[model samples]
Target chain A: DTAVSQTPKYLVTQMGNDKSIKCEQNLGHDTMYWYKQDSKKFLKIMFSYNNKELIINETVPNRFSPKSPDKAHLNLHINSLELGDSAVYFCASSLRTNTGELFFGEGSRLTVL
Target chain B: SQQGEEDPQALSIQEGENATMNCSYKTSINNLQWYRQNSGRGLVHLILIRSNEREKHSGRLRVTLDTSKKSSSLLITASRAADTASYFCAPFTNAGKSTFGDGTTLTVKP
Candidate 1:
């Protein structure tokens, strides 16, 4: 079974479009996060939810919003996507106790043309 | 700006050779971890070394941590072609938040 899974493996949309990516984890982890990997292979944490509570919110643009209905799921919604939003989004989860280790899902590639 | 910085942004080596990647962070960390990501895939956990620990080994991969310098290194011995991937170092704080550095892309040629 895939421990962590994210939908819309590939997304190709025009500029100013709205898109959402869903992520689910079966590992029963207490913390889930959304990460953006830029073209330079630099991974940055966008948001993190610990047991459905927002814990880490980086200085991401207001166009991106993250929702966590529960500890097992986290979703990202991009509003008015722009060309700069073209990147890979990865969903990851880790046990609250072992925060150093993370289980990541197959990334969702977003292409804004 | 506080994220870890990996050295030798890209590397290419023979299948049988060893590969090493270094990471330097700006502040003290609770632990340092390494991860690998293949083309178009998510990151995979490799190893984690605590600040108090100096070195750790998992299979053919060795990791060293120097808290004094806020630096860490990952060494993969006898690398195989299948080992070609991007390696990232993440130094985590006590708050369960870790920042990843720009990864080192390693290409192991057969």
Candidate 2:
């Protein structure tokens, strides 16, 4: 079984277009996260949710919002996407918050023109 | 601000050789974790070393933590081409936050 999965493996959109990426984890983890990996391969943590509660919210712009309907799903929605939004968005989950290993999904690549 | 920053942004070694990557972090940490990411793939957990621990081993991979120096090193023995990937270190603090570094790109040539 796929432990962590993200939908829309690839996304290509124009500037000002809004898009959403969905993520689901079956590991029964209490914490889920959204990370952005830039072209330089630098991974940055965007948001973190523990048991459907917002735990960590970095300095990400308001254009990006993360919603967790439950403990198993966390989705990211970008509004009026800009060119700088082009990168790989990864969904991860762990047994707890700020500790233990993280199981990551295959990642969703977003390319904005 | 970033917590952990790996040294030697990139390393290239031949197969059967040993590769070493170092990570330095600011402030104290509860634990440190190492992860690997292949091209176009997600990061995979490799090992985790706690603050009280000094050394840990998992198969051909060895990790060492020095809390006094605030540094850690990951050593891979008998590296193969398939081992080529970017290695990242995440230093987790007691305040419930961990930040990943830029990562060390290890290229094992066959």
Where does candidate 1 clash, by residue pair?
A: none
The CAPRI classification for model 1 reads as: medium
lDDT (C-alpha) at residue A23 in model 1: 100
Any residue pairs clashing in model 2, and if so which?
A: none
lDDT of 2 by residue, A1-113 (tens): 99999999999999999999999999999999999988877788899999999999999999999999999999999999999999999999999986778999999999999
Candidate 2: list runs displaced more than 4 Å.
Answer: none
Per-residue lDDT of candidate 1, residues A1-113 (tens digit)? 99999999999999999999999999989999999999988899889899999999999999999999989999999999999999999999999834679999999999999
lDDT of 2 at A95: 94
| Model 2 quality (TM-score) | 0.97
Docking class of 2: medium
Interface quality of candidate 2 as DockQ: 0.70
